[model samples]
Target: MPVRHRWSAAAFCAFALLALAACGTLNTVSGIFGNQINFTAPQLQRYLNNSFPREFDKLGGLVSATLTNPKLTIPPGDNRLRLDFDVGVRAVGAGEVSRGRFALASSLRYDPATRGLHLQNPEIVSMEVPGSGSLIKGGTRELLNAVLAEYAREEPVYRIDSDLLARLPSGKRIGSTDIENGLVVVHLDR
Candidate 1:
C-alpha cells in the first residue's frame, strides 16, 4: 500500500519564497533559507584597522589620545566580541605622555535602516597601564571610556552588504546579531 502526504499552504508558500530568493545563486543557501549571514575574524579586523588610529581631543584640546592596532576576538560562549587596542595619551602643554592598554567587550545589534551591525552596551573588562595598577582611576580613564562609548554607539563594527541581502523589502531586515563560532552571525527577520 502507498501512503499520501499533505503539505500545508503556509509551508508551501515558505518553501516557494526560499526557492525564489535563492535562485540568483549569488547568496548561499544558508543565507537564503536560514536567513543568516556570517562574518569571519579577519573581515571584522580589517574594518577596525581602517577606522583606527583614531584621536579624541574634543575636550578643549587639553588631553588627547590615539587608539591603534585593534585586536578582535570572540571568546566562544561569551556571546560578545572583545576589542583590545593600544592607547597613547599626551598632555597639551606639558607634553607628558602615558601609554595604556584598553580591553573592552560589547554586545552586538542590527539596524534595519542602515543595514549595519553595531556594538551595544560596551563594558570595560580591563584597562592596564604599565608600572601602574589601572589607569582607569584617573580622569583620563573617564575620557577614554567616553571615546569608546562613542565608537560603539556611533560607529558600526560591520555592515551587511547590499547585494548579499538585496535592498530592503519593507519589513524584511537583519535582526538579532550574535557572536558564535568565532564569527559574527547576523539573522534576518520580517
Candidate 2:
C-alpha cells in the first residue's frame, strides 16, 4: 500500500472515533441530567416573596391592593401552595384605605397548551383587618372576596414562564406537576 494512502486511512479512522466519542459523551451527559427539573419550595417562596407584591399591585380596581412581606409555604403531604402576606387596600370611590393580612391557598396545575404552571382555585382562607369594627370587617371580607373572585377568573396567582420550558431538550415537555413536602416537582417527557 502507498504511504500516502495509509496516512489518509489513519486520519479517517481517527476522525470517526472522535465523532463517536463525542456522541457518547453527549448521551452520557443527558442521561445523567435526566428529563425532569425541580423547583424547590424555598426557592419558589423566595421568588414569590420578591416579585408577587409588584404583580399584585398591577391589579388596579375598585379595591386596589398591594401585597407586602409575602411568605409562601407548602404543607407536608399536601399538594396545595399557601401564601401569606400583608395587604393594603384602597376603595376607588369611598376614599377608604385599610391595612390587613391574608392567607391564600391554591392548587398547582400544569397547562400543557401553555407549557406553564398555574395556581388554580385560589381560596382566601383567612383575613384580618386591624382597627376595624366587626361590621366593617365583615363588609371588608365580603368585598375582598368579590374582588378576588373577579381576579381569580382573570389571572393565575403565578405562572411559570413558557421560555423556561422552551429551553428544555427537543420534544421534552412538562408531563406533570405536583407539590410534595414543600417542593414543586415538575416531571418532563423524555
Candidate 3:
C-alpha cells in the first residue's frame, strides 16, 4: 500500500505561483517566489522519505527487490534531479542475494492535461554493490533498469487533480525548470 504524501512539490510550486498573484493569500510564500519559485532539494528529500522501503517482485516472483533510503539531490547548475537509492535484491529459494546502490538523474516535465509532474529522461547513473566488489550481473542489471524505468513512468513527484494549470492568469504557464544553487527553480512563461 502506498502512503499518502501531505507535502507536495507541485503544491509548493503551484501555491507559490498562485500566491505570486494573490500576494496576501499565503504568507509563507511571500519571499519564496516571484516570476520563478525555488523548490529546495531538502524539501523534496523530506517529501520522498515517507514513501520508501518499497518492494518489487519480478521474473514471475522469483526475484524480490526492496528500495529504501532515497537521497535526492538537485545538482547546482543542472536541470536534472539526481536520486540515489539503497537497493536489496534476493532470488527467493535460490539463496542468492545482493545489496547495492542505484542512482539516476532526471529532469522534470509537466502535463497540462493531467496536471501532473513527471520524470523525463530518467537514466541510471550507477549501480554498485560495494560488498560484492563487482557490478550487477547482466540479467539483474536489465531487471533493475526495467524496474527503474517502469517506476519512473508510473510515479510523479507531485500531481494535482484540478485543472489549475489551465487557469493561470494572462496565459501564463510553467516554463523552464532547472536546478540552481542546489534548488529546483521553476520559471513561468509570461
Best by lDDT: 1
| Model 1 residue 160 lDDT score | 67
Score candidate 2 by TM-score against the native.
0.63
* TM-score: model 3 vs. ground truth: 0.67
- When superposed on Cα atoms, how far off is each prediction in RMSD? 10.1, 10.0, 12.1
Q: How big is the positional error of residue 29 in model 2, measured in Å on the Cα after superposition?
A: 18
Model 1 segments more than 4 A misplaced: 1-33, 112-114, 131-137, 167-171
Ordered from best to worst lDDT, the candidate numbers read: 1, 3, 2
lDDT of 1 by residue, 109-162 (tens): 887666677888888888876653354347657877888777766777776677
For candidate 2, lDDT tens digit of each residue in 149-190? 655555444456656656778887677767766667677776
Q: Give candidate 2's error at residue 35 in angstroms.
A: 5.1
Instruction: Note the Cα lDDT for every prediction shown.
Output: 0.74, 0.67, 0.69
lDDT of 2 at 186: 72
What TM-score, computed on C-alpha atoms, does each candidate reach? 0.73, 0.63, 0.67
Per-prediction backbone clash count:
0, 0, 0
lDDT of 3 at 146: 72
